[model samples]
Target: MFKRILSGLLLAAAVHGLTITKPASADSKLHEADVKWQTVVNNGDLMPTAACQADAANCRTFNSYNQPSLNAKKRVVFRARSKGGKGGEPVHGVYTKDMSQAGPIVRVLDRDTEVPQPNNLSAVFIEPPSFPRIDSVTDMIATRGNHKPVWEYTLADGSDTKVGTTGIYTNPFGPLITGASKLGAVNEFAFFEVPEFPGTPFDVFPGSPAVTQGSTIVFKGNYTVNQIGKTGVYYRDLKNQSLMGAAGGGEKAAVLIANNTHTLIPGTQTVFGSTAPPSAAKRQAVFAGFDNEENPSLGGIYLAQLKPYPISKQPMLKTLVSIGSQVPEEPKDTRFNRLGEGVSFDGRYVAFWGAWGDENKIVRLYCPKEGNKDRSAYCMSAASGSSQDAVGWYQDKSVPINQGLFLHDINTGETVRIARTVTDFSDFVYWNFSGRSPGAGEGEEGDEDGEFARWRSASFLAVSSQIKRSKDDTPYQVAFKARTGALDTNNTYQNPVDGIYLKNRSEKSPFATLIQTGMDGTAFDPKAVFVDEDTGVSVVLPVTEMGLERDGFRNGRLAINASMGTEEAGWAGIYLGEFR
Candidate 1:
């Protein structure tokens, strides 16, 4: 038979208080008694059940009797009855402070009810107040009443303190005030003001604020008012209040702005010097998108040189391309795809991936030398039929390649395929074509379809993959490589058939090395490699992966954005180890 019972009482001691004991357990059968505290059900009805028995103050029973061992400590259990003839009801247990003869305490209901109820009653363990302990009070002024009604509390020092107008009582923490409406009770209240960094006229209200690492807090919000002459951005410092800083034009400043198409490409600046940049000295760059007023073409690129510190001189901004100007017109139609995976500047040449005509994939190169505009920019064609998927340029103006790698002279526009093959066009047609296809017919002309082999890059390292077949017609090896010139059949690891990722080393060297392997699923898609000329190490940022994966690598940080179906969630994270 099911028999509910209460076992011996257990005491939960607090951090700053003395320990206390409750009623001792008896070596006898316990009888159940209805608890004064009732639980409100989902249907808006209250149900009364025996929480525990007299002898067993902490023990309760459901289908199977739960009898505490004679010498065991007391534990309380609350059982819920199943509805609609459902068999056994599950019992839940909770620990509370020891209360020998306490009646009841109020517990605020978490869920909403039919009527607006303030609070509810529940049985709980209460610790007795320590002697000479003081509790600070705040006055809560009643807005509905003609004369303000105040709630006050007396401290341990025999001093009566008034809790002024809707504030919470805290032991040592500062006052948590609840705001009152101008004419009636406030429907909502929040701590919107930035406590540590005060006196800035920017929007401080966050949609969701999270407290991190003791005193640090992070939140996101939109700027509502852009007042002229006001600081645009501000950061609070706990160590020194006087070290606070702000930036941007009040009325015209926007960290993130939109283009004509309403695509959001906001302005962002990263402060790197020892001291924060003054408002006038701060350098800003805009991310191009449809919503931005300046640049409307989707694949437009720009370059600007800003002063590192001091507000004395204005920075120089240069327009790299005005939207569709990068690509050519008509029969030589230039299809502008998304910006290639990577970008970098070496104070000399700027290299990027560009698509021309329908089948001509090439690498676009530009030299920043003064007055060299007409002859400064040119295209280096890739392998005859292969697309130049991604590209990167080293500090010395050397191009990197992957898949169909090739090299071309900037001055002459001369191009050559880095890797050569012994298999002729006829061999490819004979193996891949059939009698039904034109190439396989007895009298039909055989067209070469084997021109698909192209290297991905020529600078840094170009990695590619291919399945090698054994003499017995069995798949033998998967090859990968990072090649500068033609594929070196002599060096095994030098031309790895399995994909590889290269990063620039940071030890004041011009050379870069393979830092990651593409064989692993976690490895990013190798796109463009950016190497720190001072350090030989480099960072590899991938443009697309198995599942439309896109990533960005800057400095030593990596960011990955993955889209799943209709919903997308991503995070910018850091990875250890220099790109060697």
Candidate 2:
């Protein structure tokens, strides 16, 4: 394991801290890696300007699950979306993260393909690709023909030997596949039909199809157990391409993994659903979702896991700091109930977002103590000068109010905030989408339909608030604000904390050493890339100015700014961070 020398150093720093610990290594220095961005494609290459203006549906780049992974060629894989879902035109494409292998972008398949593919499609993976981990690989879930999901994988045992330059392998798409059959075609008895026998992965009818042998396509669609009487939740097999909780046991499909029931409380309209694209690989699927009400305060961000088989062995589901869900430590702190976006890889740490208001009516920092569950039940104040009791907590009126990114260890019950809204980070994150020519968008706001965000690897996330106008006809200056191009660089505004914010999260506490600060005696826009140093998470290298622009945020605000869904929803350019 990597040395744990940092923890003791952190405790001592809190005794003489500026809220954030000081950085002691080169890796912790802001922009330590000189994180520069490399742009991809001309803005016009996305979708037509008229199309986006016509409706948000017409101009989606369909870029989802954007964490780059190599194909057999080692090129980055991403989705090109249009109107998505069952018939959306989300074509898969590839290129280099640095655009070094530059050429025309390669489309995996489209209507013009030899087989003439469908229009609607989305590419979501259970595991993500990142830097510093070169020899690693992951599995992917993509559209064979929009929603007819197929698995694109590599052989784990190297069982499928690759032939020389000819680019042929014994198993091109790897084994455990049934070749790629549609949902209905696989099981003659339909997934939701009554099971001829229970406790098995098969049906009971004589005409039921055989246990799909080749590769079968799966669908993550809506299903109901009317006869058994169930309302919400779904359980689908990641490997075998099958659906569960349909035939037997009226058990609520409302579970995450095995038996880790989230605060899902028996039965309540405390609504919950997958809030972000899920990350998956071999036997595990790491994901985030939320339980909410009309009042934002009643909802919370949560992290959960799902296993392909024997679904009972699900990993634990931790409340990664539920906003609306009362904190077990401070049950009486009822005013702050909330939630947010998140990501995970290989079931490591589940990092998410959350926020709570304060009576201070201003932004501030609050640290907690792992006291003897019996120590004074108050938040630690910096005063008593020691983290031994409720003395390490303090508020700085200069900071923004509530909201922050957090990480939770599924294996361990530890959770910590990487940065707080308006304090450590500005709420208004930024991004670039060279698709939309600049005008038209925003019917509603939310990250529900792959709109406002993109999770790169489990440790990195890029978030944006609204959009802005084109300055100098260049994509780099598209400032994000409630109004078009309202950001005045000359003014020292407190700002709503909006703009593109790249958060490098970890399950560990603040670093023991702080990065260098700006002239104002503060560090704004510090770059960080969190990788597991050994048994826990730590910053390996500080990235420069929030990383690249992979995809558009949700389709919303003052004309095509950012969110998650619809790639061409705004006039912007896509860039990959130079993480050297």
Candidate 2: deviation at residue 106, Å?
A: 2.7
RMSD of 2: 20.4
Model 2 off-target regions past 4 Å?
Answer: 1-33, 36-75, 81-104, 114-136, 139-220, 224-277, 281-283, 286-293, 296-305, 308-320, 324-336, 342-346, 358-401, 425-573, 578-580
lDDT of 1: 0.19
TM-score of every prediction relative to native? 0.22, 0.41
lDDT of 1 by residue, 367-416 (tens): 22221122112112222221232332111112222122122222233322
The Cα local distance difference test for each model comes to 0.19, 0.28
Off by over 4 Å in 1: 1-286, 290-299, 304-317, 321-337, 340-500, 503-580
TM-score, model 1 to reference:
0.22
